[model samples]
Target: MPRFAANLSMLYPQHDFLDRFAAAAADGFEAVEYLFPYDYSTQELRARLSDNGLVQALFNAPPGDWAAGERGIASLPGREAEFRDGIHQALEYAAVLGNDRIHVMAGLLPDEALRGKHQAVYQENLAFAAAEAAKAGITVLIEPINTRDMPGFFLNRQDQAHAIREAVGASNLKVQFDFYHCQIVEGDVSTTLRRDFANVGHIQIASVPERHEPNLGELNYANLFNLIDSLGYSGWVGCEYRPKGDTHEGLAWLRQWKAQQA
Candidate 1:
């Protein structure tokens, strides 16, 4: 079955975290994903998932200074301690929620004083984090945010993600390929996906032009998903889009469109 994860951040912005979680389960979604679940207790969140019979698919590892507009700092210099602490905190939540992967958003670059020395530190920290994640049976993912969409992000291209994965040298470290961002930054999504199939770990999408529901967007999700299925991808597909109205009302497109995929 193709698991659908309601992006609580965009889908149910108006609802409390757990309420939307319950709603996702009620709507027949077997899995759920959230951008940041730091505000809720893993135990309490886990209980809700259990009661609703939903799988915890994925969650963020924490992007530092979300409020200060700092974006993230995983690869930034002199902040290795902060970065590792964030990963540890994320494991606690992910372990409780039964989530296997963590998205580590690459934060903004540090001051030029540390520029030459910082990237080495970033790679080393990633290797350490990956090793730790492997011990916990959890995989750590690095997502590249396109500069066109989100400027000042450290990793803004697939090549950067690929380099990080290669440097980590751990099976547990992989790249998160968000199609919407990839399409905007670099077209030919299928070719890039196929080329990096081994290293690409997770995917998220909204749509072009509107960044809303899938069927209304330009990208042919049916063909895209067909390609994914043909690749024997058994992983989940995250419905990480903004709902036009209530999240539930926007989701009717899911059942309405996928049925035609047959």
Candidate 2:
């Protein structure tokens, strides 16, 4: 069965940061994920999760500093120090949470001036991160966020993520493919996912155009989910979307879909 994990950060923006996890559990999500978990202490996060029997699915490592327009510069020329530090923080958090998948923000790959050097740095960093993550029995995920949705973000293609995985050559590194961004940057969701499913460790969804809950936009999410099920993908399908209304209202679509599936 394709189990759904709610991205608590997106689903319950109105709630306090720590409370979002419990809210998702109450909303019937067996697993919960988010963009950043750095604000809360690891002990507090784990306690909140245990109290609700919630599984921690996926989350990104720190992105240097979001305030300075620095998303992630893992492949940058002079930011390797900052990138490594961010990765350490993520490893600490993931280890404490008992979660295995840590989404690595690829940041913007350097421009053509030193593109070759940038690629080299990315591969080297991946090798080190993969080994460290493997030691913790954690899988590191490299996601390709759409540049249009998030300008200056590097690693914007599924193929790019695949290349990074190959370079790392580790069993613990995989792609965190997002449907909403992919649909905006590239259509044919089914074919794209099917072609790169082997590299994919996590999946996410949202309606196109508005980036809201599924079933209200261009992507035929039910069919997409069905395709994922049919393909025997046994991974978390994250509800990573901006709710058109409150979190509860957005959840009706998911609940109704579950009843139909039942």
lDDT of each: 0.80, 0.84
lDDT (tens digit, per residue) of candidate 1 on 164-233: 7886688889888888888878878888888888787888877875778876677887778777877777
- 1-262: candidate 2 lDDT, tens digit per residue: 5799988878888998888877888888889898888888999999989999998988887877778777766777677787788888899998888788988777765365666787788777777778878888888888888878887677778887798788779988898878988888877778999999988999998989899989889989878888999888998999999999889877888889889988
Candidate 1 regions exceeding 4 Å error are 110-116
The TM-score of predicted model 1 comes to 0.93
**Where does candidate 2 clash, by residue pair?**
72-107, 107-154
